[model samples]
Target: HSRGSRALNDGRDVVLMDADDFFISENLCSHISMHRDASEDGSKVKSTFFVKFYQKLHAEGWNLTLISRKPEKLRNATIEHLMAEGCGSWSSLIMRLDNQTQMDSQQLFLRQRTVLQKRGFKIIATISSQMEAIPVPC
Candidate 1:
């Protein structure tokens, strides 16, 4: 079994999706303007502004959850980068396993939504770059 699968089976929490689907940028403007080059791997990209935003959300009592398709090998690096970027901790780091590499963002979101809801979280909103994939209420 792959390290990614082993990590998922360890039982913290896992959300399935492709790695390319995730994105992070320095700021909202840059995020919108340079969406093509954004990378969610924190070790590769450092965003102080985004970190502050995440901290602000946490201060406001929002439980920030990171759902990514990153593998086990990158978990510590991602965590370290997040800490260096000023994020103290997060509510969860839901990752995708090796077998789940083919899952789409929508399915990932839905499954994790259900999991969070069952755990007594009231999801206020979902922020994603792929608007087409996520369902919206008319």
Candidate 2:
């Protein structure tokens, strides 16, 4: 909370981005989360800035909903990581567990896109970064 307050009070620009290597900098980011490894236990704390982002948002009446393709346990772990990383306590964040659905990335994206559109949300801008995994013959 103090960190975010400090950033805002200092007139720093708060940016938001997925947890990709491309967007990392010393700049103050308002929010950051893992994209490719969203479900991993260790990936939760791998933010672009710091956990104070969530704290600051909460202070400013921001309700953060964390959607995870991981199990309920891992989702909870992410929250834990947030707290440990400096968000203080993470009781304010909402966690949605998606493991039961077993949806792939494309399916999840389409479903979320439709739902968000129906909710009157529009995508203003999108920056795409592609990652591919190559098979190694044993």
Candidate 3:
């Protein structure tokens, strides 16, 4: 049986693999398309609406937090992109999905919300591309 099958069946086998192995190769057409979409230039253009919204929220004394499914390898790139889009203040609030946190977007959002609530911050709003990430009745 495959290691993955064994792990699933009995939880006894330990599988080791590099995180990079799961990412698409740079040469693949899909990877290229995704790279273009995530590029700094593309981000600057696509982020205009959100940037304006965030600026408005900031003006209204609301602190924004970013929760992303991006891997840790792209953390610096994410930060630089945020800074370029005039969101430097939010760089410190970025929460990225890394290898250790193997939770879905909804779980991650709930975890982050709990943590933030403990810090005395009332989470009045959440902006997410994925509707599943936002709990109903929130």
Among the numbered candidates, top TM-score falls to 3
Error of 3 at 136 (Å): 2.5
Please give the CA lDDT of all the candidate structures: 0.52, 0.37, 0.48
Question: lDDT by residue for model 2 over 1-138, one digit each (tens)?
Answer: 234432233222222212222123222232353344433433334443334455565476432333333345544455555554555432222223455356554444445444544655442222222221111234
Model 1: how far residue 127 lies from native, Å? 2.7
- Top model number, lDDT: 1
Clashes of each: 0, 0, 0
Winner on TM-score (1 vs 2): 1
The regions of model 3 sitting more than 4 angstroms off are: 1-46, 97-101
What local lDDT score does residue 56 receive in model 3, on the 0 to 100 scale?
Answer: 60
Q: What TM-scores do the predictions have?
A: 0.58, 0.38, 0.58
lDDT of 3 by residue, 23-134 (tens): 2332212223534434544444434656665656545444456665565667776566656557655413434456536777567667766666676555555664356556
Global lDDT for candidate 2? Answer: 0.37
lDDT of 1 by residue, 14-94 (tens): 322222223354331233353353354452343444454466655555555776655555667566656655665666777
